[model samples]
Target: MAVQDRGERSRRSILEAAASVFDERGYDAASTTEILARSGLTRGALYHHFPSKEAIAAALVAAQSEALMVPEHPVRLQAMVDLTLEYARRLRSDPVLRASVRLTVEQSSFNRPGMTPYRQSADAILGLLREAERQGEMLPGVDLEELTQFIVGAFTGVQLMSQVYCGRQDLMARVSTMWRLLLPSIATPGVLMRLRTTPPPSVAGAEGDGVREGDAETDGTARPPVTPRAPWG
Candidate 1:
């Protein structure tokens, strides 16, 4: 058990270090030696976990899927908004996530394969939108799949622009603007009023809230139930 635990720790160290290097220097420019130095792990240990630099990059790309903590809300649309807002907050603080975003965006330039992270994110959003539609939270005639694609694309652009312009310091604000613009078109008026573009004060302070990867539940805060109002006469 000790040996296995040590191995796991070693692997994580390598990945974190590699992520930092990749975050600072693009994939093509980041060197294994720099990762080794950052991790303080021997060449043999790194090779034991990741055989090549591309493998490290692939692992980082895959890690992006775990970055968002999607809480369950009675209203699927509210949950979607929470997911985006929380993700934007995280983008400002999580190094691994930032690196994952960078690698995913630059994958074509780096000649790496597998966009599983992007597909997984799209599928998750699509599922939420589909549920929102079923519950009549979405606008009539809304295309769930197309809306999913649009949200994902818009988020990617927003985060990238935030990173480029303000070093992501204003990501949460930018995300709020995005949600304000998108909700009117995607959600029913009642749902739109109930959804919050900004994170609640508690949630904002808990930006560093340490939820484990793959955990679907929120950190015990009660979310408001979705209440759809009657359309205006």
Candidate 2:
């Protein structure tokens, strides 16, 4: 029992330590030796939990991406932009995510494993958009997949821009700009209220992306209960 408890503590220590170092130095500059010294773990132990630095990096990305899927809050956004904005906020706040962002921006290759964290994230956003369409929370005239990618990809672009320049604390204004530009077309006023009122809480951040990825893979067979929608889309 003691051994297992110690193992868990060591694992968590490494996770936190890595987050701190990566947060401070960014990913490419972070080294296993530095993470080991910070976490108070031996190299053997660190290697046991995460086989490679890239794997550790993937774990970090997974941690933040997972946060976006927490159960809907009362004041959360019901429209597509609102949903994506919540995710962008989480990415901004999370450490592993910042590293991933840094890596994606700095690195030039799609062949790298580092790309996987966000690889499926875009798909998840599109999945939710499709579900919104099915629930009648979206207009009837749009092409479902195209619109989903368009809306989601647009937010991704906005978030990347904000992250590259403004940092998370000031991101809301830019995300709000994206929201305003977007809302006029697809989101009804009622839908916008849900978004404006229900920004995702920090507590619910980083909880359920894997379940959602699975849900999306099954063609949303396990779609979450729809957030309340406006009377018109």
Candidate 3:
């Protein structure tokens, strides 16, 4: 293997192993030894990618946002909704996201030098909200910054609650309900009527009921054409 490719593989293995350890033991109890064992790598290999446990934790937290990727929807608000739902769905199976959430909530246990994961998540949603506003999907006078923060905080709580109650088996439904309650306050009346609370079948996985047929364009506002964007996974 090429030198760079071998190095990249080792780095990915270290991260994956660290994610599992963090997800299982959390930041306070997770150790470099455990991660090294999980990765089946030598001490040198592990340290080459991550300097310490804190560095690994920070990396995981930074990567949490990657799991929120979803395809662009014509309705920017719908895309925002899909973003949260996709995250919820991923929490059930994605170890990186789960570990990231664990490390984020347990921030006091470690030293996180850069921006917090919550801030990154809020920034992403804020960007979407700005687009929604430009497209006339949001209610007038809505403060995008405040709304973005609230959505991020609320999802954090909802997902944590779901995690404790049922191991996050119900996260998608809980997040769907979250959007249902909050959409009325922030979305235009026309947009509110047509926005889907549930994810589409392709993104929904097994727990999701998926979007119903005729669910789109039911608000009598002609579905505005949207420029296609790159798909997120």
Candidate 4:
């Protein structure tokens, strides 16, 4: 038990140190030696947990999805919206997620392994949209795959703009705006009315406002659920 716990701690230390470097320097400029130096671990220790710098980058990329996992909301579309808001909120503080995002954009600089982060994000949103469709929340005949890809692409553009404009300090607001413009076209009218386009205080400014993410409410006034309208001929 002691041996396993120590190994886990060491692994975590290496990942955290690597994340900080990657977030700051992008994948091409970050080095294993610097990661090891920041981790305060021997070369052998880092190599034991991660054989190469690419391996470490891959691990961080794979973990980004975990950080965005929101609790299942009663309204599935709301859950989808919350996932993006949570990601925007996390970008302010989560080194791993930031590093992963950096690596994703710099994919041309280095060989990124396994599934791309964009695909993973699309898959997650597609799952939520599928659930929302089952619950009659989406407009009929909308292409789930195409909509998922567009949502992921739109978010990528928004976050990049936010980062350039204000270092992602206003990313939550930007994401909320994205949903506001998107939901009307994709969601049932009643579902759109029930959804919140504003990021709750927690996602907008949890640290500054002293509100917890859990305290954010998902519910609005109940309205009769409306069936989706068929596509126009």
TM-score against truth, every candidate: 0.86, 0.68, 0.83, 0.83
Each model's C-alpha lDDT?
0.78, 0.59, 0.77, 0.78
Best-to-worst lDDT order: 1, 4, 3, 2
CA deviation > 4 Å runs, candidate 4: 200-233
In model 2, which regions exceed 4 Å deviation?
24-26, 73-82, 108-111, 188-233
The candidate that wins on TM-score is 1
Greater TM-score among 1 and 4 belongs to 1
lDDT by residue (tens digit), candidate 4, 80-198: 98788777767766787888887887664568753578878888899999999999999999999999989998998999898889888777667777887778789888787778655
Give, for candidate 2, the lowest lDDT window spanning 10 residues.
Answer: 211-220
Give candidate 1 regions above 4 Å deviation.
107-109, 207-233
Between candidates 2 and 3, the one scoring higher on TM-score is 3
Candidate 3 lDDT, 27-85, residue by residue in tens: 78888988889999999988888888888877888788787665589899999988887
For model 1, where is the 10-residue window of minimal lDDT?
212-221
TM-score: model 3 vs. ground truth: 0.83
lDDT per residue for candidate 1 within 27-123, as digits (tens), equals: 9889999999999999999999999998998888777778666677898988888888778766766788888888878754466645666688888
Error of 2 at 109 (Å): 8.7
Q: Write the residue-wise lDDT of candidate 2 on 15-102 in tens digits.
A: 7788778777766788889999999889999998999877776666666566556345332225444555556555655565565555
Clashing pairs in 3: none
